[model samples]
Target chain A: MTTTTAPVRRPTDESQVSVGIAMVFLLLMAGYFLLPIYWLVVNATKSQRDLVTTNGFWFGEFQLGQNLADLFARDDGVFLRWALNSLLYAGLGAGIGTVLAAMAGYGIAKFDFRGRELLFGFALGGVLVPATALALPLFLMFAGVGLTNTFWSVFLPSIVSPFGVYLSRVYSATIPEEVLEAARVDGAGELRIFFTISVRILTPALVTVFLFQFVAVWNNFLLPLVMLQDSTLYPLTYGLFSWQSQVSRYPELQTLTIVGSLVSVIPLIITFLGLQRFWRAGLTAGSGK
Target chain B: MTQLWRRRTLAALAVAPLVALAACGGASTEPADGAAPGSADCAPTGGPVNLSFTSWVPGVEEAVTLWNQQNPDIQVKVNDVPAGNAGTYSNLFNQLKAGTAPDLSQVEYDSLSSFRLQNGLVDIAACEGVTDAQAKFVDWTWSQVQLGDDGVYAVPQDTGPMALYYRKDLFDAAGIAPPTTWDEYYQAAKTLAAADPAVKITHFPQQDANWFTGLLWQNQANLFDISGDQLSVTVDSPESRQVAEYWQKMIDEQLVATNLQGFSPDLYAAWNSGTVATWVSAAWGYSTIRDNAPDTSGKWAVAPMPQWTAGAKNAGNWGGSTTAVFAGTEHPAEAAKFALWLNTDPASLEILNKEGGLYPASSDAQSLPALSTGVEYYGGEQIFDVFKAASGEVDTDFTWGPTMTDTYRFLSDGFTAALNGQGTLTDALTAAQTQSVDSLKAQGITVGG
Candidate 1:
């Protein structure tokens, strides 16, 4: 491969025009996705009255503090509880789902046990089933044991991500078998070798799995909706929807819905950005020669 | 003849068989077939009684806090529930299925029969202060809890007596006095439309089956007659068609706006912009307009609904709810006690009205600070006086069927079709009548062929 860059060229008019056109298209694509977030942030700063009267895309007043106070303080601080519940479900759910997926994927990749391929096929099949389809069955199963409306009802079902396992197994191929052999020869136990050597090799895959599972759990609507009868037990999605559905009866909820939606989104954005380095790293994980 | 049958059945039926046929509906009139609705004795347990209540009313916690403060031993926990249609009823049904139902739940008047048919409600009549407090509520409200059986299944929480909420300024500017009869209302509607087509005298609420039912209720046009095990569906009667045709004429003549459904954003926008001139709504709907159209405050006034005949004293009702002790509750006595105080106590009634925007079922609410005052939102009109009168005028004979939810859907679809220029309102009622009877029979309710 040539180390020298292609002879440095000044920007010709034609090349500049092409780059400019692509830049415009890229900027437009970014704006398309970010417009709602921008609208949400702008509207979150407005009072309930300003929400209807003012321009939706522009700022109305500096009332984010008051809005938060109102949103959190309304319904006896249930919104804050819902936010915390979202974080708990997503954080713990993703952490556990990723670890389980990593172990199962690593086992299937490194070992030749019977039913290993069958189990891999099952995990791949699990990825095909939408979460909505399982919500009702999960609800009935949870209800059978007097577990519905409990934290475990929503949490128990969320911690099994077959896609995460599939990704982990696929990524596990990147870890050389010689690395595991050397670790075994050095007197490291299987668990220790997987925890230290294999986990390091699977970091990118683990992070991908965690991000996918975290977002899924955080934005999950159907499971919590069916399992939870209590509003206090609701995640952010369900909680916001409850407020939204009542907007006709209580118009002030319109503001809270917007503000609550904005607040709920902050954690997701932070989660994605905080782990974007690893997420990006996973995108190029097996592409290396 | 049907009333005679009901009187006899209430006294003769056994409680055990009723529980077996609960989903087919009898409003389980005694302790259920389980540990729930506990013992029959109305005596309070000497031990600490913890009861859970679920309600859709806003600011319910304030009343619960007061109840908790006064009786620390009988602590009542308030569960936040959305409005009935929003999921409260579904949650209650889920709880009933799981055998984990809350001690008390908010059941709407129209839905009471449906719940009763499912055997979801417990007979609280035997509970202390239940029967004695019957006289405190309006007569119609008292009958709602009874469900044609001798048992008081619930305490009536709120009543939504119908009244005319009109734009006082617009009426005055147009020299149109509030109509006192349906004929006069028709004239006034024409006058408003002729003067300005943009400003309608009222919007026909096509999606609001409850409101239309209220109009029927005022004319003594009840859609159901439950006699023993036999149900008579009367939704397509002369009384219903008379009311339907009058509204149909309004639609054909373009005297009123159409397509504004129940509590939609478009309806609120119309109210705020003064495009809608009058809303024939219930007493509890005061906040709906006040909160949604804050800018249009002090421009409204309340009046009694236009009569069917001149000098007649008939009024409709729209929405009301009861606090029912669930069939699965372990503390029926405690639940009944809380229900009584929540609905009958003056302070609790006042708080419920002021904070939750509820119109109390108790006659004592007529004297509450919330009702007695001249509301600033309605140009200092003693608006509730109209409702208080309307409440008294509601026909005690009017009854809800066991399949009101399905009936509502059928009628709403019909009304939507009628409004869209497909058929007349009378046609809608006739179609709804057949469908309602079919649904009743499908639910194991015996309907007259």
Candidate 2:
């Protein structure tokens, strides 16, 4: 037998040049992303007068604590109420959305039933429709049913996440069919098997879907803006926008708006960091399968 | 077969919550029907009635509280909405369409026509003593609240008569006087620019269409005239072009700064640093300037707006608002009484003037000691006297059209383009004229180009 040896390859000069170019591009993107965030952080610590008179990218005075105090104290602590409303909307919306998506996706992927392809095609089409386009029609329908201006108005539409359904389908394909067959043969009920075996396997994917939906519900502004009129029902995004529109008349609210923005970003950061491991595992699961 | 069974069970679980929620959704709860059109009783009922009023004006709550304490039968609850005029109007429009609008809303004079045209406002002509109430307000302001001769739409709350606020120190240093006419104004611009490269004579806020419209209003450029159902728009008329071309000439020579937007930090900084020698503002701007530029106190003075003709006394108005009752209110009588009392009552108007810093549109309230007293910020000058003269000189025939907001937006875009050197001011006016006609037509209104 002829012994054929593979040729050993070395990095070319052009490859090194490309590495340098890639590094430059990455740094430029880093600055582009971080500059606005840096500006927000720097300005959040400033007093109203300093915000107007001082340089935008540098600290003028350390008034973050005072601003936070004012933010929670203004209008009888309405900011806290808005923050809680946001949590309720995003947290519950995402939690429930993930479960529904997981069940639907698992069903469609494992089942060979009539209209299976048609159902999946319908879901794919749903994913193509922009959320904003549905907002007006949804508002009219809700108004017709006397559901507008309620917490349910914001919560109901949020739970119907088509993108989450799509992600869960891609994830459900990675689940092993033989494992489910083995569980069924062991005399376990289907619901029991799903709860015990399938759920454990899908935990990482579920977390991924939850996080995606959570961010979406938290960032949604237009739906809440159009649906809710009672300020008490407002989420942070809508509440802050209402306050910002009055900044020209009430200039003191400028500091409150900046400080409120900084405070609002904390919950999102914690959620992202806490669930980061599952995200990575979920991403690699599909590739491995 | 097992997979199909599991899939059916899963689908049932997925749809259960949505089905439950939809089942729980109750039947439509329509808004309380508004009082019959001609039968709205606007008299105060002896028993207590609750009324909700929405406004962005500061201290309105305090004034309403005073009224509440005095008259327990007519309770008015104040809600503060967003302060932007356009935003407030849109919110009101949405609420009105949804049949959940407040009993009373704060509407500016320029925006009143839009609501009236949409029939969103209730005719308050039958309100107690509303006919005789017209004589209590300034002549020009009184005319603004009236639709033709029979329909009374709102109670005038405040007026903003145009004035020229100049830096006395700057004028003294340049050895130049405040311009009395448009010709003198241009000459002063050139002289001031030649004297100091850093200082411009004034700022022409390209984003402020209201200010530009005020100038047009002063020159007798009747941009909109409605006769019966036919609407005539003349935004690019010769009179308006004359005003635009004059400013265009000053802009070309770099005699005026067109960089700053009104009520912005940059504009405040410019004023504080004395880089802008003059500000063409309304009466309300007096307090704003004083509050913003405290260090520059006693260095400023108010002058009448420079005339288009040397001896003419014609003037224009900018920002002012009125309290109006919505047609959808269930408590029309209490709402109407509250709206009229909020503006015409002495105690409320006094508090509105003293605390809210609102220049009173009521002639009776105009002579309040708070308004006539010399302001220490203006070098102890009676600044309201200048505004008082300007207010009287405002043309009584001036009126706003139904699409004032859209028209202002078009003008702002055109002005911004011109200021950026993409076109001349005359070209911008022409563009605005064409766009305004087209937009008005699209709104299903009859328009004569």
Candidate 3:
């Protein structure tokens, strides 16, 4: 038998050098992505005086506790009220939206019902619509029903995530139909089949839908900006934006806004870190391996 | 086949009503507070007149409260719209359009014409307490609230008479005296540059439309010539060209820093650090500077703005607001009464000035003993008196056209483009004029020749 020459490893060669370069590039990109977040964290520790004087990226005297205290104390704990509104809007809205999207997506992907394609097409069309253009029409509609300034105005719109449904549909399609058939053969009802068999297998996709809906509802501005006129009803984004607009005349708010931005992202980070495994699982499963 | 088709038709009919009902149910939910009390409630013996006054600042309510203490029958409730220029204006506009506009509204002088165009303003000329007090206000400001044949649509609440606030120590270091004319101002800037390249009279960012409008006003240029609804565009006038050229020269010489757009948090820090040598500010600018740059106390002095022509007046109002009654107000009389108390009452002015940085409209309010007291932050200078001395000279000839706000923005952008060498002064102004005229026409507003 002819012996194939053993390939030599190129530890110092051009190809190896290129790989090293790529690793450095990726590290730099990672740093670039994380820098704003790092700066936000450092900023939260600063006093209003230090905020203007200190380096934007460096930590000054630790005033995170003090800033939180002041933030809650200012205007008689309006920040707490805004935070509660955001949590309700984001947390509960995302939870409900995720389940609805999952069920809709699973139904579209797994069912052989009539007009399924038309229903899928409708869901797809929702993804193409911009949220801003919908705001006024939504406002008009909501105003007619007398819900324009209430929490329902914000929550109801957030709950309908067409993009989330589409993602869930695509993800759910990969589950082997044989498994669902086997569950059905075992005498499980359709709802029980979905809840027990399909849902357990679709954990990764559900997390993705939840995360997306969470962030979408959290960072939403225009809807809340138009929907809520009362200062007492403002979300963190709208409340901070109101303060931001006045920063030119009242510069003290500049620090408050920066600090507010820092504190605002904490829950998002915690959610991501806590649920990172599911995100990874979704990505891996999405590759169809 | 007949049975299946009939079932499908029945299903369609069943769903149609549900969809219509859902659509109907989704829209009826805007929260609207009750409108102000009607004329019936304005009777002296009527229970009370509850009025809603929409404002974006905090201290003005103190003034309202102060007024209410003396006049218990007329009750004013204050709501702070989100601060910042756009939020304040747009929020008010939205409310007005929704027929939920407050009984009294605070309208910026520059935006007064636009507000008047919507036919949403109440004429206060016939209102009690405003007849003799008209002469007390600065002439230019008095005209801002009056439009289209001098229909007095509002009461002047404050004025922003421009003055040069400079770092005395910085000027001393450069061994140059403060400027009194535009030529001397340019020369002084050059002199300062020769001493230290970093120093400038102030930072002028291109994004601020108000600052440029103030300059154009100082140059005696009107954005529009409003005569009988026919508008004549004058943004390409000699005075505008001159202002543009001066700004370009300052930019080429690198005398003015472009960092301060009046929005930067670092702007106050720069002032404290002495990087910015001077700022052309109105009376309202004092509180911002004093509060932010407390470290530079006593080292700063106020002077008249450098005149555009030799021996010409050296002042332009920065920004001022007025109290106006919306046209939809159910209780025009009560609204007018509340606005009058807010604007012209001496006690109200005292309370407002104490709580907020508002310069009172009433002449008697300006003459208050408290205003004459020296400011510790300004090194014992009776700053209000300095502002008062210059407020009267503010030119009343300037007019706010329907497209004045749009034209002002175009001028700011054009000036920036010119300063950055993207185009010549003449070309920039011409383009700005064309763009503004085009925009006005697009909006169905008439422009004069």
Best by lDDT: 1
Model 3, range B187-280, lDDT digits (tens) per residue?
8888877787777778877777677778778778777777764666777888878887887778777788875667466787787787888888
Model 1 Cα shift for residue A227 (angstroms)? 3.3
- Residue-by-residue lDDT tens digits, candidate 1, A1-289: 1112212353456666666676788899999998988988999998866665456779877899988889989878999899889888989988998999999998898889999999999999999988866765565567789898789999988899999999999889878988889889999999999998899878888998999999999989877766776778889998888778766556778878888999898899898899998867866764774
lDDT tens digits by residue: candidate 2, A1-289: 1111111243566656566776788889999999988989999998876776677889997888899999998767889999999999999999899888888888888778999889888888889987765665576568778887789999998887777777778867877889989988999987887778887788888888899899999999867866776667888988887778766545667778888998888889999999998878866775786
Ranking by TM-score: 1, 2, 3
Per-model TM-score of chain A alone? 0.93, 0.91, 0.90
lDDT string, candidate 1, B1-449, tens digits:
33432332222122111122233243222223543353366666668999988887878889889999999889988777557766556556545655667889888898887666666888888888899998899999999888876878889998889999999888888899999998988988878777778988888977789899999999989899866655689999999999999999989988788967767767777887888899998987887788777668899998899998899999999888999988877678888999999998887887888777788899878778768879888888899899999999988878887667678888989999999999999999999999987766654556774
- Please name the candidate that would achieve the greatest TM-score relative to the true structure: 1
lDDT of 1 at A260: 91
Q: What is the lDDT for A211 in model 2?
A: 91
Local accuracy of candidate 2 as per-residue lDDT tens digits, B1-449: 33442332233223321111111111111112343233346665557788878776766778999989988888887765555352456546545545667788888888777776656677777877777788888998877887544567888999888999999998888888999898888888877777888888888887789888888888878778766556678888999999999999989999888898887878878878888888888888887687566558899999899998899998878888898888777666677777778888888888988766788888888878888899999999999998888888888777677767667878888889999999989998899889878766654566764
Score every model by TM-score: 0.88, 0.85, 0.84
Candidate 2 regions exceeding 4 Å error are A1-21, A112-117, A187-192, A284-289, B1-36, B39-50, B58-79, B84-88, B286-298, B346-357, B364-385
Better of 1 and 3 by TM-score: 1
Off by over 4 Å in 1: A1-35, A53-62, A121-125, A229-231, B1-43
Q: Quick one: best DockQ, which candidate?
A: 1
* Poorest 10 consecutive residues by lDDT, candidate 3 chain B: B17-26
* Candidate 3 CAPRI level: incorrect
Model 3 lDDT tens row, A257-276: 87778777888889999999
Clashes of each: 1, 0, 13
